[model samples]
Target: MNKAKILVVEDDRAIRNLITTTLETQDYQYHTAAKGSEALLEAVSFQPDVMLLDLGLPDMDGVSIIEKVRSWSALPIIVVSARSEDRDKIDALDAGADDYLTKPFSVDELLARLRVALRRARQDAGPAGSPEAVFTNGELTIDYAAGCTYLAGSEIHLTPIEYKLLCLLAKNVGKVLTHNYILRQVWGSALPGDTPSLRVFMATLRKKIEPVPAQPKYIQTHVGVGYRMLRIPEGGPAAPLGE
Candidate 1:
């Protein structure tokens, strides 16, 4: 049974009930709050492993809550909102949300995203030490110490930029990296044409690592938002891209 603790912050009683019911069926521990103030208090008091937040909170905007929580915690926050616009997604993502789910979503999809966030949270909670020396995802292995990446046991040469991009995505496997976040981390700042440049580099990087770039097993794009590195199971079908 799943043991992840979740904090549900939504003003709509029906929607809140739907989410809590889903969590209950999975045997996930959860606490609910109807207002942003109560949500923050529960966030601190409950210390949940993840948060399912609605952007349109009656007390305050969910983005503000995200910012407040980010100040003291690295807790995973997934925005579940009726706002489906690209701008809304970018705003929440940029404000530090780990993932965004538009309303009218499937239970399966919601559970999938929660699993991804839990994986990332567990990774972040690893023993305190010098950071992880290497990253492995399926056939891909990144040796940070040696500054080299290998695919299927063969060293794959990558441009400096491509290598950095790969490292960033690998380090953040399962968490959606917004375009602005990617640009800032890889390019050090957002400049004109940086987004296009990032896409080109990502495509080249995929060609080297993915067995079938057309149907990628590792990188999942979020259209206008950004990309996420999928942790695929051996011999299992890859999750759908463009989520």
Candidate 2:
């Protein structure tokens, strides 16, 4: 495989130099940008495999950059920021950042997160003739690794959480996954108890797979209980865009 390309976007001269030297010493190809606009330009031209983005930029908010870039691309974005608020992390994730690291972080931690984010990004940009981790019913194909449904051979867009939930449901097939089970497994122990999020995610999944989202056919919600997938076919829907 070719060497991975990394973009380090930071306003601090000292930190930028430190990162540049570290990457160079390790023999990784890298680019540097102190502002969002320049970073964006370099992003498109440089074609980085992963981006280390600082939330506070001289030209624009880091969240804004993520939103704009995600409009056209799915490049892995890791937010390197001094902002430590949970809400800030959530905002970044919601804005399409794949991961977040607060400032004063260790280089080792950064490197570790880098591996994870890049792995996920590469998986998202799956290769041609990728193994079908799916079974179809009528018009839907479920990708196991990617966790998204395909309609008529076209890819369907889905939130990260929604994707996970989908994989859980699809993998089980006829097995019923209870509400608490889905919540605990997908949301983590940090978030305990009821999961309104699961409900919302189910609705989104139904919209993408069901011919009529209002009354889902694939994902059936068992009242006061959970959800189930009847029989997974070889693949999902066959649309223009592939999943």
Candidate 3:
């Protein structure tokens, strides 16, 4: 097909139909699979440009499907599911899904995100990054191109969202990214305005990346504004994050 082929792997008939109708209206070539096995076949045969995956499947766990598919492809996998728990969302993303959208999403917002994700995937996998992909703060390094991050020489494990949030703040640097801004950019469009959950996640992240969990060094709190990534000044050696 001339249009970009999109795959929707959702078991719910209503949700599948909704997504298909939306894709058809947009003039996109699409395929649908109601089970994980069928979705695997679709992946091999249909060669979809993007995939919308639902976590709950009768035969296989969503995480397994993601792990299996990621073995070969870096396709932009945007998860579509009713599961709202933090661990559920984090598991999908950490398993290699590129984005997540909870249930009852607006069609317009989904389409906008679809366009953006496709464009970004292409740019990221392009010949050379527009601005390069490494962020360095003296001894600390985050090489996004390599899918690896390090402090001094050893690597650290960060949940997918953690890494994504870090990359966002690192890219912006001195800019104070507001709480809502952080939520929308990293979480999704549907996140509620009152974000105690976001604060919880941020606290967990700070514990992972702060020089002192009690007193953060690299990620600074801007009071009620938000957080900014700060560089330790020359001749001043800040303790390592997670120390």
TM-score per candidate, chains pooled? 0.95, 0.58, 0.56
Query: lDDT tens digits, residues 64-178, model 1?
Result: 9999999999999999999999889998999999998888999899988898889788887788934589888888899999999999799999999989988898888888888
How far out, in Å, is residue 8 in model 3? 0.5
User: What lDDT tens digits, residue by residue, belong to model 3 across residues 1-243?
Assistant: 337889999999998999999999999999999999999999999999889899998889888999999999888787888887756766676576766677878888677557645655665666765656777765568998987778767788788988888888776543345666677789775266546776777788877776577877778765554566654445675322110
Q: What is the full ranking by lDDT, best candidate first? A: 1, 3, 2
Q: What would the TM-score be for candidate 1 when compared with the true structure?
A: 0.95
Q: What's the CA error at residue 166 for candidate 1, in Å?
A: 0.6
Question: Where is model 3 more than 4 Å wrong at Cα?
Answer: 128-243
lDDT agreement of model 1 with the native: 0.89
User: lDDT per residue, candidate 2, 114-209, as tens digits?
Assistant: 665565455456668253476555666776765567887898888888778777765554434566667767876426445576787788777877
State how far residue 202 of model 1 sits from its true place (Å).
1.2
- Of the pair 1 and 3, which is ahead by TM-score? 1
Model 2 worst lDDT run, 10 consecutive residues: 234-243
Please report the candidate that would top TM-score against the real structure: 1
Model 1, poorest ten-residue lDDT window? 234-243
